[model samples]
Target: MRVPANRRTPLHEIAHARAGDKGDTSTLSVFPYRDEHYPDLVRELTAGAVRRHLGDRVRGEVVRHELPNLCALLFVCRQSLDGGVTTSLALDAHGKGLSSILLSLEIEVGEIEVSPSSPPR
Candidate 1:
């Protein structure tokens, strides 16, 4: 997940992801490689950001739930399972690929100003 020399890098470099699904709802959990990055990661990985990243693949709403104690972000993407594994014709109806796709999102590297909501490192 290491990106070229630049001011930005893929989120995967700083975090890892896990995904789960039930019916047409999919949840993606983003855990930071270090808790120090948790706040910035949360600010960057909003519901809207995930929604935009997924584009038309997500027909319904995208919601993000924060878990500060765990230094993780949980994204709930609705209507994202291609109508659930049982109905979808696609082989990956479970939406496992969505987790990897989330990891592909870019985040600022080098130095980034911490937001007021961010916790101390």
Candidate 2:
């Protein structure tokens, strides 16, 4: 994925956040390869597919943009919100019948704290 030029966060910030902190809300980055012939992976990554892959911890949101080249799906999930929390699972295409064709899959989770609206900086 391409990051906006003005953005300050690093490309691997999400992974770092997941590893450095616990119990904080996280944003996960995912990239899945559905098929070899397809140019994009959206057809393979349906809402149900994402739900099943992410399990029960997350809720998915569809954010549409005018840029045809930039299509994406976002998922929001809840974390401990207290202290020291950990969750894990295996994400191979065992039952989904996509084990053989799936060439690449990546997931990154990070902690983010959103508060009430702040005054202009």
Candidate 3:
């Protein structure tokens, strides 16, 4: 486990994400700020872990697609928003904010990987 001895930070600090929905499924793309973090991202960001993290919001198994060439991960979240945005009555109809929500999940980072003085892209 890459647990932090100091303080933990969210994925947004080291990665960028985009989310979209089709019917009841939400697809998220997470791209690391640097290529060096791809392996670490792969080790830490598993489908089961994401499934557990999202809990009931995610009704089915999470699917993870590794893109080493791009240093990114694509996550397919099934039945995540009650239903499709068009059918769901939730305030966040498009599930647009889910990316930010995902980015909020904590992960450990070394000072070299994420410096306080540096800005996240």
Candidate 4:
């Protein structure tokens, strides 16, 4: 079994994210800044973890989709929007800020690991 790393860091430090919304569902895709960190993310960035991190913002479900070839994880959040973009009065009705919010979640990471100065495309 793998033990948690000593240091805790926000996901944004290790990865970048993009967000989209359709109706009341929000989708956020996260890609590691370095390929080597993919495994750690895969192990720690779970649906429950995201759901818990998102808290009351997500009302229905959070599903995690693994994209190993791209070293990415996509989270599909349901009932996250107050209504759709057309109906919600939220400041972020489009849910574009959801990516930033998800990136704010902190997770255990290796002490030896250093975030890249710039993320790769």
Candidate 5:
């Protein structure tokens, strides 16, 4: 799914997501928007605020992608002991603020498993 470069849709607002197997690792690709604001949202969410919220639940490398007018953040989080990946998204005031411009935000979650033969043959 390709978002244009004008509309501003929150990541949680993503309607559809897909998780697929990729050579022993799960791959999740989300189309948070159909317009431009995707990159901004990706940037803001992957920053300190969101990272802090994730805490120890997240591990491994975090990769970010930016285009002329597109952006995305990818993280290889640790699978929970329950064998599921847990995730969450929250929006609140930055500092000494009263109200937030973000009335509310949304989040989408997808999961995939890696294939066994992905590694060395």
Candidate 6:
């Protein structure tokens, strides 16, 4: 079904995410549920946009890598781990939960057909 024009929806509704971290950088990969949504993801999920959405959680730069063949976007976030897994005092020292936070970000889907088969978070 088509969602309203300019309507905001949490990214989880359209995509799924996976995240991993090494040292101070976190790598997040987001895949849209439908391949047709790739361009929309590319347009909306910019490096600056992710950095702004993450706020102080990401102290360094956010770089986005596009994988058009996979219909995915990979975000490399620097200085986000509070140091590293061993050094950070944060509860989620590995930054595993960052994907959840990333999914919570709202995007304007306009009139796209959101798949009802979107998996649960």
lDDT of each: 0.83, 0.30, 0.78, 0.87, 0.34, 0.89
Tens-digit lDDT track for model 2 on 8-114?
33222221111122243333332322222122334344445444644543333422112224333333334412222333332421122222111223322122222
Where model 6 places Cα greater than 4 Å from the true spot, the runs are: 114-121
TM-score of each: 0.83, 0.28, 0.82, 0.87, 0.35, 0.89
Which pairs clash in model 6? none
> How do the residues 21-97 of candidate 6 rate in per-residue lDDT, one tens digit apiece?
99999999999887877777998999998999999999999999999989999999999999999898899999999
lDDT of 2: 0.30
Writing each residue's lDDT as its tens digit, candidate 3 over 16-65 gives 88998988899989898877666667877898877776777788779999
RMSD of 4: 4.0
Q: Which stretches of candidate 2 lie over 4 Å from their true place?
A: 1-25, 31-39, 59-68, 78-121
Checking candidate 1 for backbone clashes, the offending pairs are: none
Q: How many backbone clashes does candidate 4 have?
A: 0
What tens digits encode model 1's per-residue C-alpha lDDT throughout 71-109? 899999999988899999977899999999988988775
Best by lDDT: 6
Residue 65 CA displacement from its true place in model 4, Å: 0.4
Sorted by lDDT (best first), the order is: 6, 4, 1, 3, 5, 2
Return the top candidate by TM-score: 6
Instruction: Compute the lDDT of residue 71 as modeled in candidate 3.
Output: 85
Question: Looking at model 2, which ten-residue stretch has the lowest summed lDDT?
Answer: 11-20
Worst 10 residues of 1 by lDDT: 112-121
Cα lDDT, model 2, residue 79: 42
Arrange candidates, best TM-score first: 6, 4, 1, 3, 5, 2
